[model samples]
Target: MIYILYAVLYGLHIAIPFSIRTEWTVLIVIALLRAVLKLGEQRTNHYIAFTLLAIIRDRVFQALRRLCPTKLEGRDKGDLISLITSDVELLEVFYVHTISPICIAFLVELIMVIFIGSYYWSLGLLALAAFVCVGVILPVIISKRSGNLGDELRADNGELATYMLESIRGLDETIQYGGGEKRLQNLTKKTIELSEKQSRLNKLTGVNLALANTFILFFDIAMLALSSVLYSRGDIGFDGLLIPLVALMSSFGPVTALANLGTTLQATVASGARVLAVIDEEPEIEDITGKKEIDFSGASLENVTFSYGGDTVLNNLSLTFPENKIIGIVGRSGCGKSILLKLLMRFWRANTGKVSVSDVSVEEINTANLCDMESYMTQETQLFKDTIAGNIRIGRLDASQEEIEDACKKASIHDFIMTLPKGYETKVGELGETLSGGERQRIGLARAFLHDAPFMLLDEPTSNLDSLNEAVILRSLKEEAQDKTVILVSHRISTVRIADEVIGMDEGRVS
Candidate 1:
């Protein structure tokens, strides 16, 4: 449209020299209109891009939630973070720039060809051919030559991100072991490799752009030459010679945008594929929905068999725990103590037999209800960067201050918390780095206490606590055992000594 107006104004300047004032007024109006259209286009494009990005982000988060713990086990945390952050963000290229411009280029090229062809059939054909080459053919060729470079670049980027995060998280260990220099060297090597891959991609992008420019230049020269020949033969006039030449030269804008997208689109496609892979991953255990909620009475594993990757973790395990009993599970490490608890929690499906609660198969129980009825605490408690009170309240979001404190007392950490500078308000640094291991364990106990579920699964709950703290926590567990079924998993005989019954395990067998 801008080129058409420019052509008409140029012709007027030459054909009607006295109409310069009118031509100037028309030129200013066209310029202002073009500015308004450009602004509108930008506004619309950004609106679409931002809205799509938000939806994609939400979808990615939902996917993560679905894949977590089980499907995401052993997955690289940093790679997942990169996918959710940068990979998802890269999609803006496709939504904002690629989609709209491709459509606009085709439409504009069609209109330009028909309009130019009305003046001269040969010129219109030339424009059509040029548009195909620049808009379609060139991108296809460039994309093919790029040859999985985008995927390789994305994979390298993920690896680098993972390595960087690992180095940062393990910085203290690296320093203590006098391996800081080695860690730094490893990081530098990874960084340089990533940079080299990116440089290669950038070089390909530069070459692709050069080829597009060459195509535009070739078409421009060809169109002008053709128009000049028609003008000299009296087949057309000077206006005809200049108008199509200017329009064809300027009309490459839309197609040129597409040509530029070819290189970037590869990365976007790779990112989109990774994002989709996460969203499409099948969960290890399909959640049972639309099932009746069962009241917690007792749980039993009947000849349950399970494996991880092919090695048996639990085999022919049969055990029963009556309601409201403190049943201690004692086993050596790798003897399926924690695995039994996970099976009952339905984190994994048993390969054979049944893990049932209230005489109902866990898979047949509503997942939300099952989660609400059981509170499982692991040896390593995870604490977020939040206030002490906030972390404790995670067990029960609506727990009152008194309830939180009471739970903390039961966990044998209330006095310690009160002595802190900010009491319950003190912020625990990332992964509870600001607190001691025993303190973190007490916080986990507090969470379990605050939850007050019908069943509690404690895996090495007192591992980090000193003798005095362990005794206090164990006493609290015993006191709570009257109302809740407690499955206490511990290697320490002293911790399990308080339980009403004890089950020993060895090499995936219960005794």
Candidate 2:
């Protein structure tokens, strides 16, 4: 449709030699229609592209969520955040701008070749040969020369994004550790390197454009020479010669548009490859296909063994937890205490042995069903920048207002909240920075209390609190564990004493 309209429009433009012979009204109408068509094409293209981009973004986020779940121990939050937002958004160039136009341009070029052939076979052959030389061959050679650089630029951009996020998040730590100067110097070098890569990309694009422009100019001159020879031969009339030559000249706009595609699509294709890399990544563990739900009142791990890379984290570990009991896992730092909790959560599958909840192997329990029965709170509590009530609702979204308040009170945080002017409705700034360490820990405990799951795992829940706060939190846990299984991890022997049973670990093994 774009071709038919364009060809007729170009033919009419050439037919009216006198400026006044072209009816002003008809030209205006054509201009308006053309504008409308272009607008519709762009709008429709963007609408479909953006919609698909939204799906891609969702899938990228889903992959990240699966890769770094709530129980992820050491991954950087800010780095993951950068990947989801900026890195994913950069990919819109590929879907929206590049693919549609590239397809449209090729279709238009094919139509032009057919139109030329209908006029004169020799002329048609010349145009076809020129199109293949400039459009096909030149682009392939240029892209081959520059494609690796484009890929390198994109990889550098991803790394730059990661670095920026890391620097921002660790600004305070950097300053405290007296490493701010060194880190900033490193970032400055990275920024300069990124700029250099960008400069190289720009130079490549310039070279491609310059080459395409030069080829187009040469093709037009050659076509003009051929047209003049045909006119002199008397085989082609002057009017016929004039019309197609003018049309060809006008048609160069579309050809140039097509040639420019190599420059336009480079960034988008590079970004697309980056996105595909993440989507194609296989997870460390495959989900069970037809796992059954199990009643997990009690659980145990028998000779469980696991490793990350060549270093074993848990070697022949064995433990059993009875129903309605609170177990404390205590050990020196870097022991497999946290690794055990991760295995129980199935965040990492054990290489050998079995983990079961009430004699039903955890691997055979549906993931969603297992999530419904267990709640694990890591050492670092991540609170969104939302109202206090909103953060607590993450534990059990449907909990009534009264239930929330009761949980808060049990966690010994209700009084602190009441002290604030807005109380439960008060906003906790990013990561709950507005509140103290004690407050964040209490909020975490409140979440566990509100969730009221059959199994609860708390890693260093009271590590950030004072004696008074810790005692109050321990008392709250005692009350909440009445009919539930609780696993507590801490270095404080005093904190460990509160559990119904204590398990000590050393060097990735039970001691």
Q: Rate the local accuracy (lDDT) of all candidates.
A: 0.87, 0.76
| Per-residue alpha-carbon lDDT of candidate 1 for residues 118-189, written as tens digits (9 for 90 to 100) | 769999999999999999999888888887788787788788777777888888898899998888898899
lDDT of 2 by residue, 1-511 (tens): 3333334555666443333434555567777998998999889888987898889988886776666553234665544554566556656665555567667657866777777666677777777777776767776777677766766675677677778778888988998999988988988999999899889878887888889878877877877788778878876655546555555655655555555556545555655665677677766655565675667779899999888789888888889988889999998887788878888888888989999878888888888777778888878777888889999988999999899999888778998989987889888873346678778888888888888888998989888888887788788788777888999999988898899989889877777
Which stretches of model 1 miss by more than 4 angstroms?
Answer: 1-28, 430-432
User: Which regions of candidate 2 are displaced past 4 Å?
Assistant: 1-30, 68-91, 264-266, 286-293, 430-432
Deviation of model 2 at 226, angstroms: 0.9
Best by lDDT: 1
